[model samples]
Target: MASDLNIARHGPQDGPPILLIHGAWHGAWCWDGLAPLLAAAGFRVLAPDLRGHGESPGRKHLRWTGIRQHVRDISALITGLDQPPIVIAHSMGGFIAQHLMARGVPMRGVAMLAALPHTGALPIALKTLWHHPRTFARILTRLSLYPMVADPADAARLFLDPATPAPEANRFHAKLQDESFRAFLDMVALALPGKPARPYPALVLAGADDALFPPKAEQRLARRLATTAQVLPGAPHDLMLSPHTETTARHILDWAATLPPGAKPPATAQTAPQT
Candidate 1:
């Protein structure tokens, strides 16, 4: 059965819980150092590897599954939590967070870090990378890529900070693999809601140099929500592993501090869904 695939974790036992979902080509391991930092700020943290990522089982061969399934998997886990925890999503995980709360919800808030709002339009670079023959062959071969692109150096530059201690990015890259195509399909299919969509008290962050979620998507989402969005200038896609990782984490902690309680229902923001 599909479920939230968990990875490493560290934080307070009884403090407010923050559910962290990672992006494509990454797992909860990406949150390794950040989890403890957040925990020090007094929060319980759950960092789960999305299915078919990290050490999770490969869903590549499955008959049929998509982003909706991933969101449902995440929602089911949150429902079982002692409280409706705040969601800390990165990249693709941010998309999941929004989908989770498209309708009113019992969520605290969403902190979307370097995330994609809707899968409708990712950058041309990402589309090229995903569709490349070498990359496509890797996906076709094992429904994974870690083994195929075992370049720790490139992984560090593209996905983590070149300044990050060698081990962090190396270890993460060694664990990389093919993600389920269903997930990408679902991301592209995320139709805006018909009823007024939920106004997630969300934080849409971006790395100035983030080639994936460039300035365009970030500001657009912020403008749509009419909330201030923060951009980490000079940072790359691996903003977490870069020098600003700690700073970014601190910023999120500070923002989450001002959030309303988890029981309050989500507010409506987006316009009516198409017929």
Candidate 2:
């Protein structure tokens, strides 16, 4: 992230603060629906556009950035705050959040949404080719498998139920933007920082239909995090954009309800909840 990384905020200034970090190829707009929902709960929300995306400053010059770099930016933002806020990271952001806590940042709580937990590296072919000028030029000319960045129809069909209209997908797709090769390199490398995993209350959430990290994968990851995991049936990877997000948020908020800004995590989440 650049020195001018942006973490836009909303809601009451003194209310409990929650930071929502987006995943790859996504920006703060990813929380368009969820932010307002969090606000309605009388909570303050800060959704940052990481290094290369959204209105944030450093797009073209983020060559050196990887997962550790991004986590540093988030940690800096958290430290600058008047209070230690609960950090809720989604997908790749989940990895970043865990790394931040490991580095000894004062954290209220950490929640992972469909996060990647395995430390195994990305495919040799992908790691080698992600940033090749010729490779990216060729790949950019085509579609990506992730619906959040590419196909709106696919995104809608996957995220929404059969009753949802196409316009909803179009609206969501309008927020889509390009991601950096460096970001891919980071996740692929699993270069995120590591610690002995001081057990903070963690929540693992997923969508049953998430092609990226399906239910089984989420289960495996929860085991790694030593936390209980849940997947909303028929939901896709973009659970926040899904109609089920409010419910998912409440599931988390329910756990959040028991703890204050500086208090320890809930007993239910202190250890691992039943599967």
Candidate 3:
């Protein structure tokens, strides 16, 4: 059975709605710093924990769940909203967002932060591990075997900027939950070619210092999605929790303002992509 997603809503009720989707090993809590900033900027933000992550149930079946299950969860949330929201998705969440778009989910716009490619995270992971063998070996070993929880140092190396405060990094690391191995594989297996081209505007943003998805990959992904890529200097993969959180939120808000007014869809039924 699927678990109910726990959603955290912020900002005024009358503001334009924005849906924030976190990546693997992260939950709605990942948007803690970014959501309020976007909210204060006059957007209503809704961040939801994917099944088996954070406070959501179904952890015991995480290994059995894949991208299809997660897509179902998010599809339900979008359908329940009063309007098609501007989606700001990070890493694996970006992958989910793309699937949603391919399924023809209407939206005001989408902002992808260090998003994984349609081809998936495997190549990125291999490259990252090859570059920083010792550090990633420890992290990947535990991740492949345990699939839940991670070492703070490993998390810092993978997600944090070099100048990130140790305290903040530790706190963020502590909040991470176990990711689904099946979901990771599913992300790798999914491709974008056969899916219908999305008509909605998309902003592809990446961190210059992101080891996982480098600038080249980001640009390539933008090309694949028919959009230009934007890079943030000195930023890491986890931009939301980094010092650049406010800047990222502001950029998203600004981009959203530039979108066509009629892009926002009225409340409508949403159907999940056939798995």
lDDT, candidates in the order shown: 0.67, 0.68, 0.78
What is the per-residue lDDT of model 3 for residues 64-106, given as tens digits with 9 covering 90 to 100? 6788778778877876777778899999899888888878766
Ranked candidates (lDDT, high to low): 3, 2, 1
> Which is the winner by lDDT between candidate 2 and candidate 3?
3
Task: Tell me the tens digit of each residue's lDDT in model 1 across 100-131.
Answer: 76744346878878777653533533564665
Candidates 2 and 3 compared: the better one by TM-score is 3
Q: Per-candidate RMSD vs. true structure?
A: 4.8, 6.7, 2.9
Candidate 1 residue spans exceeding 4 A from truth? 1-4, 7-9, 57-64, 119-122, 125-154, 164-168, 190-196, 263-275
Q: Which regions in candidate 3 have their CA more than 4 angstroms from the true location?
A: 1-3, 128-149, 190-196, 262-268, 272-275
Highest lDDT against the true fold, candidate: 3
Write candidate 2's Cα lDDT for 1-275 as tens digits: 23487767889987878889997667898888788888888888989999867888777655446676677778777766666688888877876776776676667777777776655225322533563435444443542323233556645543455545677667767766655555565666636456524666667888887756667777876777677788788777777875777877887788788775564334333211111
TM-score for all models, in order of appearance: 0.80, 0.80, 0.88
Ranking the candidates on TM-score from highest down gives 3, 1, 2
| Candidate 2: residue 161 lDDT (0-100) | 57
Q: In terms of TM-score, which candidate is strongest?
A: 3
